[model samples]
Target: MKPVISRSFLDRLFAAQDYDGLVQLSSFFQGTSTCRLEKADYGLPRPFFLIVESLVWFAQADRSGVWTYFEATSAPRQQAMLEALTAGAPAGFAQAYAKGVSGWRDEAGMAGLDRWLSARDDENNRWLWQLARANRAQIDELLS
Candidate 1:
């Protein structure tokens, strides 16, 4: 089912501009079955993208802390949102996602992921990047 988000909620999200609020908004989607933004038919696509950009900004600002919270609370929703964007949104969304990943890697000094990020000639890198971006918990679990 598509999650119901109100305009006020969107306003609150936009106004928050902090990691705590981002976590709260993301956790709000915890039990959602789907995050098909297009299927949401909410007619507020701009706000949705704004939220995505805001998330990217927050992730860029504090990759380690924000990503830890995201892994713990928002990964599923984020993954689903990316799926929806990949399936239907314009190409810019993917570009935004890539930029977010770039910022995170660069700011966090994640040298280990450089090969994956630098393999721009390989189309598979996109999927790998998406997987890495979405599956931090899985990565940790496997390492453990």
Candidate 2:
């Protein structure tokens, strides 16, 4: 019931966690042209956009592999995703993510991503969902 902000299509997409729907919806928003998660400039609410961005990265990595994410994403976008994680996830969550990137630089590239992936047990990222739920009114209002 979060995102009680707007009555727009964004409200439905966010509440459903409709990944593809949100991706498509984002294109009509302010900052995205390619609907890339790393764009991070959706011109929506800050924490809302950050949460969605972080989850999209999580979702994409879950569908593909973490290495695939790293491979397909540019360094700046990777940095943006990391920043999104920092903004949206619990403090503990950021540690594993940051560690993986650093560990990859430790010359254990694939291993680093694998470790990070394994460390994340909650695929749904209920914590972030909870955040959205808590701020539903604000998010929805903004979208509206």
The candidate scoring highest on lDDT is 2
Taking every candidate in turn, the Cα RMSD to the unseen true structure, in Å, is: 14.3, 5.8
lDDT of 1 by residue, 1-144 (tens): 445556565456445534455444444333244334444222223323333433443354344433343334344445545555566444455554444444543535443333332332133323323433354343223222
Evaluate residue 57 in candidate 1 and report its C-alpha lDDT on the 0 to 100 scale: 34
Top-scoring candidate (TM-score)? 2
Q: Following a full C-alpha superposition, what root-mean-square deviation does model 1 have from the true structure?
A: 14.3
Model 2 weakest 10-residue run by lDDT: 26-35
Whole-model lDDT values for every prediction = 0.40, 0.55
The TM-score that candidate 1 achieves is 0.26
| Residue-level lDDT for 28 in candidate 1 | 39
